[model samples]
Target: MIKKEWILQKALEQFNERGYSEVGVRELARMLEISPGNLSYHFSKKEDILIALLEQFSARNSSFYEHYLTLSPTNAHFLELMEKIFNSQYEYRGVYIGNQYVRTELQSQDRFDYQSIATKRASTFQKIFQGLDAAGQLRVNGEDIAFLVAHITLFGRFWISEATLFTKFPDKNKTIRHYLFLLAKQLSLFATEQGKKSIEEFSRGMS
Candidate 1:
């Protein structure tokens, strides 16, 4: 039974790595070395598997962001957080962001947890911004800042996601990191010189 659960868990990972449209029941079962009927017993539809994937992803991300927020968020920490999120969501070859993009293209509501997943992530951003505001460390208003950071992060991820187009380049990893780092710098989008200096000061604590 536990093995079966592992099978399902891995399947979700694959679906997240791949997209719901690109993955199918037979392929998932093949990846797990199980028959289609057995896989169906666990997840009746591909959409059901996607829901599971998003649920697990949501829980993990929610917990991670909450814990980090408690640890005294600073600009450096925020930058790190942005980088991590980018790697998972918008990095080249990442399925999470890809699946999300595909889901948005699909009009069928039941196929994805579009709003719920997005909301959970946005709420985490809200919390972080609120914390910064309370600490008197934020130069920008929490509401507007949160909105900006969210879109900046997403856009950075979205931008770096096109690394595949540069496949002919010999230094793909180097190129990708260069772009990702540039995007990470957007963390300072709304900070004042004083606010920016304060953020720089926090870098000592980050390392």
Candidate 2:
């Protein structure tokens, strides 16, 4: 990879392995075997790197949102979309792991627009819920859909942080399957009869 890309990748590795606050810019340069001056040329401050990493995450999530718009309308497709969401979150575990740190740091800066990030994420899930409801794959009514969307969004966003409290983190596929299974259970509670049938079949196939 190029120098700038390599810096971001290595920085994420450090952030994920340790907490973001525990890693400093000079330490990052040492980890990279480069001069602190070289690192500063790319990212003057540690927060600058964090912001850049978040921008990469935002692009990924936008791509995920756009992919959903092209999917066939079915409960299965919704699950597929959900899997993509989970996969992206796992891929950027450092971001979610440091969700609080990132938010507090960014919130102090006027340029971050932190609320817009949360708003866009909520709107995306709301659209997904509305789509599923219209397709008869979900039982949520108009008012309930908002609550359901918020519920799913909150769970998906913070799940990694919660998972860290476990005695040990499971293997990646096992972790993802467990998450998917839990999500299947959650959706079953509000699924239409047809939706329930679809989710049951999906769950069995997943097993």
Candidate 3:
């Protein structure tokens, strides 16, 4: 890997294993076996590395949203999408779980407009639900759609933090399945009969 990519990879690993506050740029240089000055050439502050990592995370989520837009919407398909979402959250657990520290450090940076990001995410969820409603998989009205979107956006953003508390060992697949169940259950409340059936089949397949 090139030096910049190498630095991000090592930094992500250390950040995920140890909380972001505990890791420093000098320690990252030591881990990369490079001089501190060289590391600074790529990322001057630890927050710079954090911003890069968050960019990567945002890109991955955008790709997933784009891909799903092309697929036929179904309850099963939505569940599958949730699985991918949870997996990505697990992969970047450090960022999601240590969100307080992240927010504190990046609050004044102005590099990321978190409110805008949240707005876009809610818009995406609206599209997904609208698609499902057209597909006859979901029976949701405009008011309920707003409610569901709000809860879903909240849950998706912070589920990792909550999961880490109850999970001792944190097996990726198991943690994903647990959260998926809760998400699927929430959807079932607004799902059509066909949607319920699709979810049932999906749940059975997961077992």
Candidate 4:
């Protein structure tokens, strides 16, 4: 990998393993086995590296949504898409875990608008839910769909932080399964008979 890409990859690993506040540019340089000046050439500050990672995260999410849009809108496909999303969030979990620090650091930056990203995400979920409803898989009305979208978006964004608080040591697979089950349960609340069956099958497959 090129130096800049390599730095971002390793830096993500470090930030995920250790909280964002705990990892500095100097630590990242050491982890990458490069001089501070060399790392600085790519990212002058730690926040710059974080902004890059966030951008990558957003791009990956967009790719997931794009790919999912091409697939048939079945409950199974929806669950699969959600699994991919959860995994991506886990991969870049440091951002969620240390969101307070991240928000403060990037709040003033013009390059990254966290609120706009969140609004777009919620809108995407709303679209998917509407699709499912139209396909006769979900039995939700407009108002309920809006409420459900809010819950799902909020849950997806901050589940990592909740996991850290509730578990002494959160195992990735277990935490993912726990939250995923909750999500499936939420969908099952308004799912059609066929949709419920699909969710049950997906749950069994996970087990």
What lDDT tens digits, residue by residue, belong to model 2 across residues 1-207?
238888999998888777688899999899899989999999999988888888887788788779878986567677777777777777677755246887788778875675787788788778888888888888788788888877787778777776665633446667777888888888888788988888877777777
Q: Give the least accurate 10-residue stretch of model 4, judged by summed lDDT.
A: 95-104
Looking at candidate 4, what is the lDDT of residue 69? 86
Ranking by TM-score: 3, 4, 2, 1
Worst 10 residues of 2 by lDDT: 163-172
lDDT of each model, Cα atoms only? 0.59, 0.78, 0.84, 0.84
**Residue pairs whose backbone atoms clash in candidate 4:** none
Candidate 4, residue 38: how far the Cα is off, in Å: 0.5
TM-score of each: 0.69, 0.90, 0.94, 0.93
Candidate 4 error regions (>4 Å): 166-169
TM-score for candidate 3: 0.94
Model 1: pairs clashing at backbone N, Cα or C within 3 Å? none
Angstrom error of the Cα, residue 156, model 1: value is 6.4
Clashing pairs in 2: none
Question: In model 1, what is the error at residue 60, expressed in angstroms?
Answer: 1.1
Task: Please tell me which predicted candidate would have the highest TM-score against the true structure.
Answer: 3
- Model 4, 66-138: lDDT tens per residue? 8988987778788888888888888888875246877777776777887788888888889999999888889
Residue by residue across 75-130, what tens digits does model 1's lDDT show? 55666565455454432232354445445543465655556666766677777776
Winner on TM-score (1 vs 3): 3
lDDT, model 3: 0.84
